[model samples]
Target: MPDETVTAAEPGVGTPNVERDIEDEEEKEAEQARDVEKGGVPVATGAEEVSGGKEERDPNMISWDGPDDPLNPQNWSFGQKWAAMGIVSVFTFMSPLSSSMVAPALPQISRDLGITGDPTLSSMTLSIFVLGFAVGPLVLGPLSEIYGRVRVLQLANLFFLIFNIAGGFAQSKGQMMAFRFLSGFGGGGPIALGGGVLGDMFLPEQRGLAQALYSLGPLSGPAIGPMISGFIVQSIDWRWIFWITSIVDGVIQVLGLILLRETYAPKLLGDKVRRLKRETGNDKLYSVYDKHDRSMRAILSRGMVRPFIFLGTEPLCQIIGTYMALMYGVLYLLLTTFAELWVTEYGESSGIAGLNYLAIGAGYTAGSQIGAWLIDATYRRMKVKNNDIGLPEFRIPIILVSAPISVLGLILYGWTAQYKVFWFVPDLGVFIYGMGTLSAWLAIQTYLVDTYTLYAASAIAATALYRSLLGFAFPLFANQMYAAMGQGWANTMLAFITLIIGVPAPLVFLKYGHKLRERSSMARKSRIIR
Candidate 1:
């Protein structure tokens, strides 16, 4: 949101193709505007740099100083893209892993700390980490837009690692809880920015597999963490859970330092302009955002709160943000409740109880991979059918189906778990539920990216804030819900609420989404959907 002007280079010195470069940038901007007028996708221009010279341009063209700059994430090679995605995923995976892996070890932790309370206490340890997730994105996500993704991601991971490792040293239950919250706050970075980074590197059509891989980090980490933690807790002290992960995180930090590069375009181009000006001694360098006259403090405040602002102003943001928040809450609530169900109801050991998470993990993996392929194919088909108008609404069809499956699966799991139905039956419900979650999450994430391309960071930040808050709050009340109405009825209520939000969202967006987009100043300037 801040104005970033590239100080102009030395006056009167022109490059060999200065005039040609100006004409080329003009041609590109005109072509882009025409593409917008016709609802076709504009060609992505990597970070542009201005040559050190006085250049005249068409008044109508959006002039970018230089073309073919490698500093841009968009200009990076396929290998570079994967490298960034992988590093980001590692940071993403570590935080959630720290959160949930400790679930299996919570009982031991309680025993060692000489504390005994409700099943919710154990759940608190896991869900509190997600609370940090809710809060961190508001600051981190927006800061990335201003500062770039890589720097914020790595720094936040280190911040998370410190508190997470310190959690092991906590002398009391309250201390541990505080440590978990702080760690989660730091760890929230990857979850918020991973998709935005992918959006930066991949076009909408080519993003499926990249999204699939990225999704694996969060979805699988929770499941995989418990598996490893189960064995580790059985073999040694529960403290090792934090200590071992901290060491692993150290390795990831090193890898990040080596591979992760800045991905935000404005920040990258701004740096390039600064470098060119330093070399050429010109003072007239500028970026498009420089036309605005906002102060840095004002810009930071505006940028930090933009996600919430959009959430309030945009219908799509409200619908998508609310649904995603509910889904996220449901996820943490289920994780918290399941440990008690298996251990108390079914008489499983902590190690065996932890294994049930495999159902959630498997469902998420299959759904993400399947949904990824389905998303792009679905888009292509809709494009052909619409005479290739390719509206963002084209991404909505999957939400209709995924939302119901998620609701139904929750109902099934709740009822079955309550009546002491076969363990495998509950697992089946979980599997189906996981599948629905994958589809639902993928649909919303892709939709956000589709609707808010330039501001994807802020849009997702809004979703993250609400969702993580729900994740934090839901577990606090999980015990009461199951106790008051029993699993079947409680889940039924949840399913009903989900339906109220989920079912109408896709349909409303499909029918009225463009009209909604028409009202959005941010969406109008972005390249999300043609």
Candidate 2:
């Protein structure tokens, strides 16, 4: 957590509202004390800035220079802010692509590696990657709180890149499983931490578009990967899929090195403290965030347990996490079983089956765009109506609409495929469910982030844990479920489950979310995680 801020050393990089000069050190000390009393922890909202005359402040404690400080990610120029987001999005895209890029190639891979007998082994080929996703977030989410976003992201991405390359060379089922799991562990960092980065850079009012785009990466990546890899598996060797994804990921990793800056306020403030002490030769200068016993062990211990605590005790976490997990499991269930629907029912080749995935890709992409536009606009309108105070519940409206649509999509695809109707009908059903799922994802993520702004990483981790595990386990049961019930009844059951869980959950949030926040032990009073 070094000084990764572009303008940390030079606090005067942005225009400050104040023009008054300090006549003495005493005057500056008084001003600093007043600023602290005002509760400045970076992301300098007007209320946190100096008001007229400074009443009191702390001389040794450091924070943003003013509401206009460019070092605050919230105050950064549009280009700088979006560039960081876009780079993270690309990283986000690469990981999930790795998760499902091997879906169509499963048959080829099974043949080459002599994986015979069990269809479950074929399911493991992709689900194992998601299992790594569940494990990594338990560690990575908390580390990002201690180390900062940029460093954790860069290192973990490199971990993904190297292991993904290894996946291409895996000669046996055991090697492939190990490689895929390890690669997923590395790739899972972005999904766990990307929400925290959004909470860092954007205010509640600005979070809708950021959350939508960020959520889109992981959602769209899995849908789009199988589409591209189908042809690669059809025309070339299946091994090329891993190598090709790795090449693209490698390029994104390099751009991250060059463009991404640190977004975590605690890390930036801590780095600033070190630089200040060196310049002033005053050992007492410290960041307020660094006041805790933040030695490596303490941070590690806290970081490791924080997400679990959030998951265990917080009602918001349980309610949101459970519903999100159901949808995610459904999404993966569709991904794992989708190609077969086309190949067996519609008499399509592997490459054409992959093209059917485009229905999903188109649906998710459209949903993301619609949700992105609707969320922020809805929040802004609600905030204004509430006299300019925003609530996390503002994100609920999108889910109310999206969740039912997802259920419909599932029912449509399931029955249509069961009836062996036109190929386009099943594809249409996939497209609908895909769109509903991504829209719901965008809204759910934004709600968690908005509710626990300071502890956003942990809040997201709580939900993501459920999402990943279900994503893994659902496929293990999919073959059994579909076999006993056929496609129509199987998907109808899924849709009913979603209707039961997904619809009521957000209504609960819209009505009682604020009370839950007030009663929850994990809720933070401050704007940053302490």
Candidate 3:
């Protein structure tokens, strides 16, 4: 997490300070020129010879710093790594917190802004924020690849912070809608970038806990935010929703400036090359990704465009994206409706209504933590069974188990909430629902990461677009939906639909997913054959 850019060299070479060794500088330059003539980057031969004795060396492997360089993200101290993970999780938490914090304040916002008293309109306020989350990942996810994760992520957060504050002053519904959408666009960067950053920082085995911790941000933030927002709305005014969250986001941004550093290997190496060239006049030193033929404009365009391309063509992305989108939409729907259900049915106060979110939060925490360890263990076991070859299908078994849990949760929450059943009944149902959702989500996300690897950002972005849009759209219609069919039958309808789509999805994917992946041009290109 320190602000140092790691420059890769041969396996064991210490990067010489270009400031010293003037006598050898000219000789080194001539040697590098000869290497270039032979179409190779000038590497220190002595460094290679020194490192070769200890381990297997791949001369063609692209590296950042030496194999064991402390500057590499892989070599960072555990404390530094955890701190970085915490920073990203905090960043990830703010957007969703903003998205749902206003749930308890909907009536206040509706009254003061002169909006119609329709629950659908009120839900739109929160859902539209989710809509921005959907749109943002499509572009931001890809842009992170071209510019590196930290820069795009921080810039997007600033954009979110700006619109969030602006939402505080909106006098009309139109302004509120516009500000919410824009703020969401900025806020969504963390959702798209969080996993990719972990991929950059940690190896596969150590990544689970970090990812599980990060997963809590999006899931728990919404649950927790309204706890405070409910109190604020009852005591203060709805305007403070924007003002208070913006202040919190500002603090997060300041901490990020201090702690978040670049992790992308290409960017780090590119910076090193530029610095080295300035110091030693070695203009030819460059990364494999660096090519004179490709302009930054082209790179940016390609990075931005690839996710959509993959989304359109890759069946793996499509199936995973669809399921994940449904899960996210349901989450927002629950957040939007929890206050109404509790306050209306159980005659709870606003603060008490908000507290029900803890059920969902508990479910999420348990699912993610348990799911993390289970996923890794499953993946490792599958790897062992497959002659030490890891298949994407290695992740499918847990997803299969989670799918039915999701259906059951829907049934429990819907039927219990329909009757004036015990308050704890609905809470337990929601907790079950939350666990199932998170479990499915963790499996889908880790599968996507494992399957796509380098293009994980784009794949996630493609999913983000639909998922966020659905998150927005679901709440907008929840009131209409429940009114049309009533809560029990309505959610039963949803459960049936979920079964139709989700149930067979995992089974099909688990059995034939490898072959399906083989047909994907992107997967083929990445050489991610199962």
lDDT score for residue 389 of model 3 = 82
lDDT of 2 by residue, 1-530 (tens): 01111111234656332211211211322223233334463222112346585433457768877667777788888898899999888888889988998988888899999887778888899999999998888788768767899999998899999999999999999999999999999999998878878878887778878877788788888898898998999899999999999888888888999999999877898898899999999998877565445566655565566677677778888888888898888888888988887888789888999998899889988898898888888988998898787778888898899999989988999999999998899889989998888888888888887777656776787778888999999888777789899999999988998899889988888888878876764443322221
Instruction: Give the poorly placed runs of model 1, Cα more than 4 Å off.
Output: 1-69, 118-122, 293-296, 527-530
- In model 3, which regions exceed 4 Å deviation? 1-63, 292-294, 528-530
lDDT of 2: 0.80
- lDDT values of the candidates? 0.76, 0.80, 0.76
TM-score of each: 0.85, 0.89, 0.86
When 1 and 2 are scored with TM-score, the better candidate is 2
Worst 10 residues of 3 by lDDT: 1-10
Judged by TM-score relative to the true structure, which candidate is superior, 1 or 3? Answer: 3
Quality of model 3 by C-alpha lDDT:
0.76
Q: What is the C-alpha RMSD of each candidate to the true structure, in Å?
A: 8.7, 9.3, 9.7
Candidate 3 residue-wise lDDT at 399: 77
Model 1 accuracy (lDDT, Cα):
0.76
Please give the distance, in angstroms, between residue 324's alpha carbon in candidate 2 and its true position after superposition. Answer: 0.6
